[model samples]
Target: MRNPKKYCEIWKLQKSFPSPKGPAIVVKDFDLFLRDGEFVSLIGHSGCGKSTVLSILAGLTTKTAGSIILADKEVRGAGPDRGVVFQAPCLLPWMSAFDNVMIGVDQVFPSAPRAQRRQIAEHYLELVGLADSVHKMPAELSQGMRQRVGIARAFALSPKMLLLDEPFGMLDSLTRLELQQVLLEVWRERKITALMVTHDVDEALFLSDRIAMMTSGPGANVGDILEVPFARPRDRKAVLEHPDYYRLREHLIGFLEGQDHRKPKPVAAEEPLAISAAVLSPA
Candidate 1:
């Protein structure tokens, strides 16, 4: 958050699980370049290994091949610098929302006294619209509220990078939209480098600076990267009305259709995607 300049580089990343025939590759040659404070979403059909790639970056899964570097350091096992938010809130049922967030703040700020750490937790919890629910236990909160805590905890870390795997996938649509707005508001404060894995096209278009589309698995990889032209302080209504919004949406759907084994592969667009974002931005 201080520098507002963090970089994540993934090169030739691959993950494979042993199979009777041979190694079953889920992700292969997955190269991604994330700029400082940029939000990038990885979207593909379910089971396409988008989460696999994100997990690798989060240091939760071992890569069968390739290298991952963040802040100029190679990613090994899980580290505090990277915060992960999954579909589930993953909170401690016994702890209050505030305590759930405080546990992380305490670990990251061990030198700080309880009062200071409590302040950190309170600030983020309030930011996520959980100010009144800070003292409530996980079971006492709704699913959406629990996720709010997850988001709060992640940002409380002030992590160099954030890895989110379908953080909103399990929520109801209304709750999802509310949390998305909360996420945008909080993220705008620091713009910490973030990578999210989701299949929701509207969700990606509304929130991301760029969208990374993945091919079908086995051996899924980034097939294209679309540069979003909508200006920041994004309004959902304005983004939906943007001239290029549907075009970009169609492009994403087209890519997915092409990768769908159930149908014939889609022919490439007549316009070369490399021309500019007006056409498309291939990765």
Candidate 2:
């Protein structure tokens, strides 16, 4: 068997915040390694610092400890090499869908001719099934359409890594499924390394090469990492029929259930307060 090439590495990542009551550690000793063109999903209970991990990986948040190495370079801050799609579409109100994607392409490929940049933008938009809505504003588009613009904009950069923080958490079931398929198609085509923080177990099973299950925080860490054995061009119906699917599903569901029953440590009066999920910024 061929050895997988390492693309990104996270070692002993930790994050903490100062609270009035004490220093609350939200993430502790979290570690993960991604191979080139691999898709990994981080799954955990709400407030288990899932988004915090992504934020740190995106260079949006500073880690209190450990290291994040991408392509052999230490990640200190955000760069064009990493593209992030948040829960909200975050499209600029005035920019049309085409213009929105163009901004990212221009930033990442500044030396390219203007025509080429525009073409890149248009190509990604079409890939996401938004060819006709290229000129539509965010307000004019449906929620799902707006998110599609965001996805296109991110992919237009052709980043080495993509960070997704619950990008489909807000959509309706049908729209979520549709966007998931679109995202999978794009990922298959580009094969970019992706790390997504998702609460959906089925979504993780459908999309990731491996699922990193985290324990509940006041210092959450990876509790289990499960390899997804399903073949590519994965069909939802076919996935449901696979015998291991239910076994994996039940394992993930049971893990979260156990996490839900674990209580967080209490904060002391003299120390800084514990970091609540509300305080952490969305990636």
Candidate 3:
């Protein structure tokens, strides 16, 4: 596929939290960009602040400094246009699968008729293979099934940019592969810009158009970028068989290994979203 125009531009990104010792800087001076409707992944070892970047983009977590521009306007806080699926499904337990998804669809399409909103929710739930389980409550569903609902909910809003933070991190190997395929099928149809954070290299390789490598933290930032040369509309089998697959894989492994020596166990500090009310608003 030909290159798409610049869509989401993140420049000089920085974040820090107050520490007993001092301010703990997690990310600093991070710069990156995504083409319109492109699928990109931020890959790094744990504690590298990859999730921090995604949260900032989602407006769930506020940045200490810098700017994120999406769809031509500055991103001040979370809105319906950017959909986020975190490591955990984060669904409301009381709500049934259909209602879980409807929460977002209703918010995003409030002007539409009630029947239209129901149609939108059912469409994405079916798209994610949850058509049979639409009425099940969160406690009644398996972990993978819950994540599927989260994916469906995110897409139900018809977001312009989708932010995923280790979306498959909690699943079993078999289930992980299953969800990966499901995610791609839905994404292919939507053609929305997506940015995912993950530590799994092969998972990144299979799903991303380009992978951004981050340096180790206390002040993590972009180390390098690898363009995934595999043609789009891809499948796992074809990607594994493609020439140069290992070459790209090796480069990512090599970069991470080099950063391992400096990698401290990630800091366990959560800062209050105590900035502007815009910072505390949900994405």
Candidate 4:
């Protein structure tokens, strides 16, 4: 791995892309200071450029302006150092859970022996509590199970930074919480630097060392970086009961709600299926 301290030394990064209907997302004068192993979650309305930021970080999309530095190297194109997990699990339906993870290892470490690749995948699956389901196909798994496969795949590569675009966004409430626990376990164990984009205030509070709240659309910029001071091993019950929980949640909600004089679009009787589905499912 490259030197993480050198990665932290640069400042004032920016990115944007042209859209026929104006830029889909624009980040201006953005200054993000990230440490070696910290977890940061980005939160904003749907179109506030959360995923776009992840794309820029992953080197999957080009930045119209500014720059991105990972470890000590400037990101030129998609590199093995950053692993991205999308909102959808995006598993190969034909592949088993274990194979899905092994595929990542194959791509990132093609020279590793087949047995070594299997060992790495199995380790991550066991870490995520999916060892029993290793051989199950995507079709046989629940939404959360599919995402657990995704998580195992991403972590198995041992990426320097894990970029998560609401990886649990499609799971039900119970499944979401269950995966959150699994994620915490993997995150703590690996000490991987992570950046996650999410809409859920509670979920952000649960997983992040800091929550980077963005402004409303068009010219969205980061508004606040709220630090989560609660110590780990953080327990779900204890975190909920922490006196600071409500305060921190309300602060994030207030920023997101107050941005652009917009209220969260109410769940009408007939929204688009994908949008509707995402709202009900937390990830």
Candidate 4 deviant stretches above 4 angstroms: 1-13, 19-25, 260-283
Worst 10 residues of 3 by lDDT: 274-283
TM-score of each: 0.90, 0.93, 0.91, 0.86
Q: Candidate 1 on 1-283: residue-level lDDT in tens? A: 4233338888888787876655666777788889988999999999888999998888889999999989888899998789889889999999999999998998899999889899999999999999999999999999999999999999999898989999999999999998899899999898999999999999999999999998776666788999998999898899999999999999989888877854322223331122122212253
How well does candidate 3 match the true structure, expressed as C-alpha RMSD?
A: 6.8
- The candidate that wins on TM-score is 2
Candidate 2 deviant stretches above 4 angstroms: 1-5, 268-283
As for candidate 4, its clashing pairs are 168-283, 169-283
Write the number of the candidate with greater TM-score, choosing between 1 and 3: 3
Model 1 residue 100 lDDT score: 93
Error of 2 at 134 (Å): 0.5
Candidate 3 lDDT, 36-81, residue by residue in tens: 9899999988977899999999998999999998878899988989
Superposed by TM-score, candidate 2 places the C-alpha of residue 96 at a distance from the truth, in angstroms, of 0.4
Candidate 4 per-residue lDDT over residues 168-226, each given as its tens digit: 88889999999999999988888888889999999999998889887654444566789
